[model samples]
Target: MEEEKYIGYIKYEGNLVEDGLMDARKQAQALLGFDSALRHFIGKRAPDFRNLDFEIPVRIRKGSWEALIPETVGGWVQGGLGIVATAYFTKAAQKMAEKDFSDFGITDLFKHAISAIQWFVRIGKHMGDTAIRSFENVQFLEGNTLVAIPNDSGEYLYVPKKMLDLYTSCNPKILEKIAENIEEGRELTIGTIVNGKVEEVAIYAEEKGIFCEEEAEPEEDVLFPELVHGDDVVLEGEVTRENKTSNSMGFKYEEHILTAYPESGSVVRYKPLLFLKCRLYGTVSRLDEKGSIAARRPKLYVSHLEPLESDREEDDLFR
Candidate 1:
């Protein structure tokens, strides 16, 4: 039997997934163009890594976002005449091409190099390594590429213009059916939109706000470590005494009160605090109103954290 290969799309709140995919596409475009320009300069000749300005690590300011010079150079390389890397070439062509060196006599060396660069960039961007910010996914279908964008908190799949024809074949119901199956007898993943909007019921259950009795089974117990505080702490934690508050979900929560904090840290819970359901090391961000400490949560990820000791212990004892 021929297995049907399906391309899925997820639409999330703030359109993060889509935004991420778009950012990747934009970066890919810029990088591909720059690579083309470089190849044009080194066409029919072996690529000289010494002479090629692949990308320079040019740090701007004391602590600003550090992007490769190729990013800037690529921007320059794009010109008015549909010239992809013209902007970069006009500004620093002489300087970039100053040192001449050559190696690897590959045919269509420039084209091949550009293609390779694009592949790496695409993979890196989709894997969330680049600066282009959109929460979306990309897939190739029927000789056309599709970028799925989010609408509301619900997951919506999208495809490139070339993919519209396959819409009938790509039924959205298939996704819902698959999701239903995944959620059976299982806690929901955070940030997974069903029909749009955050899965509040699932989130609350995961947070231990509901569906937990005094003598709930150990497996049902929601145990998360208290967040670690401090900028270097990496995991965003707030030393809030347990307090009462209403979350975005409109339900009053008895969660530990979190105050002004900076950075996203490790997630104490198995599910994410945000709409997206995934365990990742994140820093807590301080939510303030009128410059006053309001609440903390909705953190960003700096890096993954070590698994909680409890997790290790469980693994050892169980498995």
Candidate 2:
């Protein structure tokens, strides 16, 4: 696998109030000053990219403020309020003409950038002169989840395994930490990179000394016309045409033809059952696609094999 790289920028928008005073241009300039400090910090910390230059061009308009990030350093602006931030991938990050760097990984870089800024803010708070305001919206751009789907071309689109790893690992950790450490008068917005864009997933806010938010339920009417890659489905059917093989890596894999009986009709699908420790009569999520001559019949990379309740007999029934 090739190493993926990215160019990250943290855009901060807000006002600087000194002695209950607010000046648009002055606030923008203050942010520009902080940008200088940010550059220095990035130079001292991320020595690997010391050559990267950052431009902090300040823009001021009617109730509109913008600060450009030109260097690699992440720093805090004294008397500045954060509204939003975004990061874009550099040319160096692209691996191939078709393949882009993983969004999950870019989000990781964004978190690191924010942490660097927060560190600077904490230090300034100790000095009692700098006050950093929390951002209402924070996002890392150029983030995406790579998904594969079959088209007319008899080739398979492969979702990189690393993408899945990053999504499953990073999301939960970030959410848990935010939920545990969220302070009073602050809110945290959570989102994921979906199809090359940042999609807001959830928000955590402090209310009545507790973080409470409504959970989003999956849409019931959202059904795919054809089974595509990365579709979560429940397959309750009989296993047929089963086969097993071992790869050069000595990994044993299994595949079987599943015939499912839905209320509308019966559908036949080929799926993989990799080291599943249960009987196959439950829900599974599609992972990858293996194109076939029959466009409708594609091999599926599936996981999360959950056995049906009927398949699990109680102690009395077993006896």
Candidate 3:
């Protein structure tokens, strides 16, 4: 079956003021009002705006062209012209606002509506130099190709398919592991290479684990790591600590912590096993906030421990 696709949108709030003139408290209230009103209008929850402050010059540039209609026309004709002018100006304002907010990483159906209208207007006006200039100004708008995906934190992460492709290309091994785990029906988490180490971005599991509730379906052709979690894999690391204790019921248990320092050190907790001076292999069952495999309280459980030979030469060789 073909997978369903969606074009996501984010909510944006901005003060219509010049730079260095905003009252932060007032702006905050306005933003809150705008968000609330927008939610009521759309009948859905409002998405967050990018935290950066935005400033747009409040100047109105006048065009060289003058109205051709004669002033001798009756008030009724003038009234009709007034209505037309107001409608067009309102539309233009909306278009400009949408473009500005989308630039700051916020989008919504209303913004999309304005964007679509502007797109059509630009295409329709292609024969004119004015349209050409307008098109040029908006040609780089991200809404032309990008879509938003809300992560576990209720914050939308804009992921363009192109961006995802670039990330996957950087590490094909991670993608392969993800595919294998998907086929096996395991929980999935999104991770990326940070400083040559895998870092967790999103986690998706049903057992009240970390991260937000999964709402959207995963894209079939491209997997978003933030929307999915879990994959089986082997990791090699040094055993850092080991402990054995008995529960209140007198049931004995054992715990071991391993630290792997490939490019950077990552700690992993696993069940008791034979001690080896060399690194041991295990699957990543959970990850911490830093994207390293979680140790003390792991969501990604490591299993099937086995030791690997050390790369360092024995001291006896120098003797």
Candidate 4:
């Protein structure tokens, strides 16, 4: 973390950038997506590294109209990777590596950022529920449901978890926000400086459609579509109880424990993930006749289950 060197840079060309100008709104949004992408890249390794700040100094090519983040965006702050920013990021990176995140640092986050974006590009299309076999550094049974990520050096322990959060930046919702300035003639270059050179990922306007969301039907229970959702029907929680014979587990989201009946994939892969945070995707049970008269915790007919980052240790609540 050197004050003289940039950890990463976002370069924009064409349209406004060609004229030595940038739209303030688009700049902010691009930064938001950029910041979000970086956060996701480091989330699994540093789940609680929330308050982070970096000095984004605006730089312009001397003759060409290529614009890095604009000075107006930084706004009167003589911007550069100042001493304060460097020390802060360095100390934080060291702390994370010492505790839960072994061999991970702020620079490694930029490196993974490139990897995540490239992996998304490699998949070509969203796999959705179609089971995916191992594809390089990643393997998944369903969207966000990773099966394994093992490497020779044991480097990929957190990759799948990284991908889970990386989805936040790649989804159509975030794409549109980041691509607001993108048009037929415009181009975006997102890169991370590794060593002395830059590893760039080009984002073309035409290629933006490739990141578009696929069409799919909404999920609803066949028997009970209108049943009141128990506890506002949140599908995320810790596994408080499990019934191995029946392949059912109790999903605890605070005080309420909802009965969760997971599908086959979940049955096979979910037991080891108990006590960790999980997001179960499926339909909540409808309020039946007997339960209609009284309140009860709803049941989750789980179609898929994906574990969150491994940080929280099993404790009294999980037991």
Candidate 5:
């Protein structure tokens, strides 16, 4: 292995107001004897970039907001009453980028500013109480006993091995050995840390202890019928209604369409409340002993169609 060598770069933010104000006060005496237009120009014209010296040299570091100036100026800073102030403030940044490229040979301005601008936005949001809210909710089911706790602040520090061990201790009836049968599943809930970051796992029964199984490749199930026309075939909506003659339970869907099987489920949009126009596929699971639907209504099954020869040939070029 060879050692890598890298060059160091420094970003500068020059202070104009403090230095300019001091110089303006000194230059007022010289401006008094000039013509009215010159006097006004002298009073208003800000000094050039070369002359001003900044009191503070804010260093750009890992968590620094130095990178966010460009984005803010381009996005929110260009509008409203403070436009003049925003323009004046960001001018230094524009000049600084030019100076950086000339002096340090850095060519890409956008890439360099991205990290800084993101940090600045993050800090601004955090300071203004707009930080994103993430909950740490957990539901642990050991045998038959179910324990659910809401973690709003992400402070669930202790997850004992014993908690997992109790799965076999209680020997719940509904518990299945999903790990043994299924190759891969994540048992841990979303947002919870497994080994510093979030991990996936599943819950099932064991002889003496409940255990976590790492993710594994899942076995694919073969669907009947090679190809169907249109994008509806691709969506593969959930099967809600099974093939059945009469529906005793009141289902409040706007329109119900019957399929070959009565107990098959209905396919709605991805979100239940959203009413986007999409197709729903349906199929019926076999009925239970009581003649009631063993599975719920609107059970949609997506039929996977094999591609035509032309489609496959066309895809090869893109791939």
Candidate 6:
């Protein structure tokens, strides 16, 4: 309960805690979301948090439903790296020794990160069709641990590599359980607290885009055997499969089946054409080693997917 050692919290309020009571089962279920979200958040920003052997202890306090992460806990691993406060380490000293972070309290960096995410969540929740700059043009200055992100306005933003991973860390499906906590008659807020101030960003019941709906991590390399190299080929195909969990998909091309993976956010805009015929512009990235090294049973790294304007007549042919 020490304010100086207090790092962060996932505090819930509103209807769920109006009476200062929550069911044991519901509380445990809610902890599932807290577990994943907190670990994922910290693990991305600090790699050592994932490597720690013991579970990070988070004590839930009474009243408004608070799960506080104490920063004073020491974490020991197989390498005898007795790192304490694995989750609350600042970006300035994420990979460095504890002395690097001891100079200042954990308020500034921790507060800024939570505050920034809160700002982003608020913007994402209300963002409709308004266009924003995509990460496609973001060029970074290479680094061992940190990189500098360049904006179109010619300003350089220095960000740690682990922090940069946050951009690709979101999995919308992973949030369904968390979002369910806020029911029709209930209200909730998931936020970080520094010192004692809770963030103002709240996830409402009707919010749709709070969590970015993009493709999660994909597994293609290890799923199959070795894929022989092949030349780039542009082909028209029907997306036979689309997996929200992974970026990989089944593509039907000219009576031949191909494994297709979208580049960037191509699938997001072209979802309407998933089961229909579409023109694909991409390289035949990999070929089946079990078959001829030719384009037979190829795998595609698609950069563009265009739905065919003309036809539903031959749609059954792809089936």
Going through the candidates in order, what is the number of backbone clashes in each?
A: 42, 5, 16, 0, 47, 0
Per-residue C-alpha lDDT of model 2 across residues 133-162, encoded as one tens digit per residue = 222222323354443323222333333333
Considering every candidate listed, which one attains the maximal lDDT?
6
Best by TM-score: 6
Off by over 4 Å in 6: 1-5, 71-120, 126-165, 195-197, 208-319
For residues 1-319, what per-residue lDDT tens digits would candidate 6 score against the true structure?
7443445665566666866577777677667766666555545544555765445456787677766656553322212333454334445455346534444333333443454445345434433211232343445556446555443334555555544556445553444455556644455565665556655666654442234232233544333233335545667777755543455666776554566777665344444465667877776654446565544345778777666757654432322
Per residue, candidate 1 scores C-alpha lDDT tens digits across 95-147 of: 54553222322222332333333232232222212222334444545566555
Rate residue 30 of model 4 by lDDT. 67
lDDT of 3 by residue, 200-246 (tens): 32112221111111123333342223222355544444343321111
Task: Put down candidate 4 lDDT per residue, 165-247, tens digits, no spaces.
Answer: 45534453434445455655667666555566767666565444344322222433342334356433435777654543456
How far residue 22's Cα lies from its native spot in candidate 4, in Å, is 2.5
What clash pairs does model 4 have? Answer: none
Q: Which regions of candidate 2 are displaced past 4 Å?
A: 1-28, 54-111, 126-319
Each candidate's lDDT (Cα)? 0.29, 0.30, 0.28, 0.51, 0.25, 0.52
- Poorest 10 consecutive residues of model 3 by lDDT? 244-253
TM-score of 5: 0.15
Ranked candidates (TM-score, high to low): 6, 4, 2, 1, 3, 5
lDDT of 5 by residue, 1-319 (tens): 9532111112211232222232333233212211121212212223331232211111222321111112122232224324553555466456766553332111122222222222222222222111212223555555534443332223342232232232222222111222122111212110112123432222212110112122232322422223221223232222222111222111112343212221333321111211122333333333335765442222223332122233233322211
- Listed in order, each prediction's TM-score against the native is 0.20, 0.22, 0.16, 0.40, 0.15, 0.43
Full ranking by lDDT: 6, 4, 2, 1, 3, 5
Clashes of 4: 0
Runs with alpha carbons beyond 4 Å of true place in candidate 4: 1-4, 51-103, 121-172, 212-319
1 or 6, which is superior by TM-score? 6
Off by over 4 Å in 3: 1-296, 299-319
RMSD of 6: 12.1
In candidate 6, position 176 carries an lDDT of 47
